[model samples]
Each structure stands twice: as C-alpha cells, then as structure tokens.
Target: MLKIISNQDFDTFAQNAKDAPRKRSHHNLHEQLDAGVQRLFISTEPETYMRPHRHSEEHKWELFLVLKGQLDLLIFDDEGNVTERHSLSPETNRAIEIPPGTWHGYACMQSGTVGLEIKEGAYIPTPQEDFAPWSPAEGEDGANDYRDWMSTAQPNTK
Candidate 1:
C-alpha cells in the first residue's frame, strides 16, 4: 500500500523539544523505503543553534535543506576550527550536502526556519557521531558557550 506522508503528519510522529532533549523535533525509523535516509523536520522557534560536530564514519553524507527560513551553515575542522560559513535563504531552495569528517553546525536566522535533513543511515549504537570537544553536551551549559564562540569566531580555511 502506497501512502503519502505529509510534513504535518510527520510532525505528529516527531519528538518535540519538550518531548525530547533537543530544541527541535525529529522523526526516526521512518518507513523501510526510507532506509539509508534519515528524515528530519526541524522547527524554527526558540532560535536554536547546533554545535559543531561530525559523523563518526567518513563514508556518509548529511544533507540539510532549508524548508522554511534562513540558516547560517558553519563548517569547521577536527580541531574545532571554522573553515567556511554560508548564509542560506529560502529563495534558493538548495540543500547543503555536508561531507563526512567535516565539523559543522547551524543557526536559524529567522523565526520559522524548518529544515529537512536527509542522511545515510543504518543507525549504530555507539560513537554514532564525533562532536567537537570544544562544544557542550546536549544539555550542558557549554551550548551557550559554543553559540557565543560561533558568533565571533573567524573562518580557518580558504
């Protein structure tokens, strides 16, 4: 049976901030047809900031498509050094395919920037991702520190 799952329907199944730990919502374990692709819909309220980090394996890529608002995509290196920064607006409707082994993060520029994330996935139990040591854990105060640093930090690459 073929069924169409709208973003609204997906949101019903996703985990909101109060339901989970993060500021946005996510829906994992989608239909089997979505295998190898981790689908997510991020809410834009509260103006969340993702800390710079990378996937553990260097073989997969994560694509972030802004479905609604603006985002500042920040790329960094192994030592938590910023490499590139991009200001993305909704007019382009393009997705940023972030390669593996690259540290990256994002900040919502508007009030309702919802992003759609597609990634290669065969969810693992441990070491699923490599987070920059300079950042904080999901619930730590370090998150605030990380955001402050991202605002004034300079790019590290050409």
Candidate 2:
C-alpha cells in the first residue's frame, strides 16, 4: 500500500516525539519496501541530541528535508570544529544532503520539529570509528554544550 502523509500525520508524530523519552520519534515510510533505500518521517523535540557522527561508507549519503519547525544541520571537521551550518525551515532552505564520511549532526531549533530523511541502508550498526572522537558521546556531561553549540553556531566556512 502506498503511504500517505497528511498534516494530521505530522501533528500526531510531533505529539509522539514529545512524549518519547528521548524526545524523538520516527514514522518509517519504507517499512514494506525494505530495500537498500530507507525513508522516514522524523519528529524531534528541541531537547533531542543527535551525536556528531558520519557514514564512513562512501555510498551512504543521507538527505534531509524539514517538513515542519526548524532544525540546524551542522557540519564539523575532524577536530569537531564547525565548518558549516544550515538553518533549515519551510521559509528558508529546508533540505540538505550530507556526503558520506563527513562529520555532521543536527539540532532541533523548535519543539515538535519534523523532517524527512532518505538514505541508503542495510540496517548495520554504526562503527565506533565513524563517531567523532573529538565530540562528546550522547548522555555525556558535555553533550548538552556540544548540542547547544551546534544549534546556535554560525557557519565558519562555505
């Protein structure tokens, strides 16, 4: 069956995300497809902490489109230095494609934010080597500061 996404779906997703322990939820769009490509609707609250990591496999590019609310796509260097940031919203550029092996993360700028994500996948665990060593892991004491910096940081380079 073809999946349909209406405004109601987003509203429900947003509510679920808020209720989730981690302040995040996902409505999988390709549940039945189950192929190389994975697609889904992600709902995230402002408290969501997306750890800075990368898909080291060259073919694993990921794309994101903001459907509601605001998000910041943060690109970092190997040393956890901010290299670029995209403030994504319906009013601004709402889409981004992160290249494979590029250290990146996202921070929700508004509560109940929703985004569509598309990427190649085989449901494998992300390797430790792909996680940014310079960045704090999720739940670490410094993770909040890192997430905050990603949310408000300005682009330092093109």
Regions of candidate 1 where Cα sits further than 4 Å from its true position: 1-21, 32-34, 125-129, 151-154
The C-alpha local distance difference test score for the whole of candidate 2 amounts to 0.87
Candidate 2 per-residue lDDT, tens place, 37-153, comes to: 889899999898898899999899999999899988888888777888888989998899999999998999999799999999765677889988988888889988877777787
Give the winner by lDDT.
2
Q: Per the 3 Å backbone cut-off, how many clashing residue pairs does candidate 1 have?
A: 0
> Which stretches of candidate 2 lie above 4 Å from their native place?
32-34
* Per-residue lDDT of candidate 1, residues 42-129 (tens digit): 6644335576778768766888887666777888777677878887666864578888777788865565556777788765532535
Task: For each candidate in turn, give its C-alpha RMSD to the true structure in angstroms.
Answer: 3.8, 2.1
TM-score of each: 0.74, 0.93
The TM-score obtained by model 1 is: 0.74
